[model samples]
Target: MRLIPNMISSLPSSLLRRAAFVVLIFGGLAACQKNDASAGQVTGTLNDAAQAAGQKLDQAASYVGQQVDATKATAQQNLDSASAPSINIDPAALASSAQANLQNAASTANAQLGKAASITGQGLEAAGRKLQAWSAQNATSSASSSASSSGSSSASADSSDAQKQMDK
Candidate 1:
């Protein structure tokens, strides 16, 4: 008791207040240090979780990128194929070919008619028959122009048949 009294008498009020403040700060620090271990563990767990989440995000991004690339490649291939020449014949070309074949058939049949007039009845009958056949073929081909893709082939057949008759 006497020692306490002597110390209080020796210390100024300002010094006492400063000393109390320092003690309180140290006491709070000591209490916080006691819980530091658990806090450190929680911080480490949070860091690991964040790392795992980052890896998952990276994987998802990579997968999406691969899918996008595949889709682009497929689209490009479709575009290339669409731009390629088709196997189907042009409608205008088929009509032109059919018209030309009909003209040729008519000219040839007229020539045959002129020759048949010089020849016998049998020659005239054959030439008349060839002309009728050519007319029928042309009619059928013209009617079916918008209906089928084989119009060009049919026209070629008609021209060949007319040539065969001419040869005969």
Candidate 2:
């Protein structure tokens, strides 16, 4: 009879210890999840492209989905004359969002547009970052904005040299 009372008393403490352990485990898991959610984040600036350049880019990009080769000439025109506004980008976030957008697009044509826009935005953003980085390193703002194959490294270097003298 006495032992029964003792066992009952010990039972509550044992249960309490188990409960504390469970709470600790749950809290740890929650914290770990939060940390994971915050990882692989990208930070950057927004793009405010010139109205004309933006419109041309949109048209050319949309056309690309329908006529990849047919837009070649028009794409050149847009790129050649574009004094487009700048759009900054964060590569990590763009990649993740683009991934999600691509998954969503697997169902329909409208989704495909979303996919296209996402892809275009990501590409432009990445290009912008690269251009900005190059300009910063080389002390010049003239990186070829051309989307065509003719944009060569030598041309970029020459342009940078010319821009330096022009800046003076």
Candidate 3:
């Protein structure tokens, strides 16, 4: 009572006026009608929106699960098919074909080796003939240049022996 008035008197007049203004504004706001119906409508709308979102999420999850199951089934089917034998092979026929190819290769190699041997033999024979002719020519020349007939005869005999040995 007296204490409150004494406190108010101790405050500045400008501070008192500001306090009164704040109190009047708050009191006026409190006297206004609050629309409870709109609040309830907003709350209901929020709940409905939340329920719709939840339903959409559930549907999306179901669709994804279905797609995953379908994919798994397709993969399993592919795996099963892959495990089954698709190509037929006959071991006996394959062995017979390989044996024939080996026989043909062996015959071809033998023919080629025989031809090479024949060509080598002919070349060796021709080289031996040429060496013998050259040796005979050298022996004749040396015998003719010797001082004695005996030495020439001996050299001719040696050349003939060498030629005979080469022929054999």
lDDT of 2 by residue, 1-168 (tens): 133234324433443353345335433432332111112221122222223234533543453334323233333443444434574444455444433433332223244334444554455455446644554544433344331335677667766665664344
Residue 106 lDDT, candidate 2, scale 0-100: 23
Each model's C-alpha lDDT? 0.42, 0.40, 0.44
Q: On a 0 to 1 TM-score scale, where does candidate 1 land against the true structure?
A: 0.29
User: Model 1, which residues run further than 4 Å from truth?
Assistant: 1-37, 87-168
Report model 3's TM-score to 2 decimal places.
0.39
Q: TM-score each candidate.
A: 0.29, 0.23, 0.39
Q: Which residue pairs in candidate 1 have backbone atoms (N, alpha carbon, C) closer than 3 angstroms, thus clashing?
A: none
Compute the lDDT of residue 148 as modeled in candidate 1. Answer: 64
lDDT string, candidate 3, 1-168, tens digits: 123224223333333353345334433432342322234543553354334434433443344344344434544454455466994545455344434443443344344334433443344344335545665676556555552556757767766764564344
Weakest 10 consecutive residues of candidate 2 by summed lDDT:
34-43
TM-score-wise, the better of 2 and 3 is 3
The residue-level lDDT of candidate 2 at 53 comes to: 31
By TM-score, who's the top model here? 3
Candidate 3 regions off by >4 Å? Answer: 1-84, 147-168
Give all candidate RMSDs, comma-separated.
Answer: 51.9, 29.6, 55.6
Error of 3 at 148 (Å): 8.8
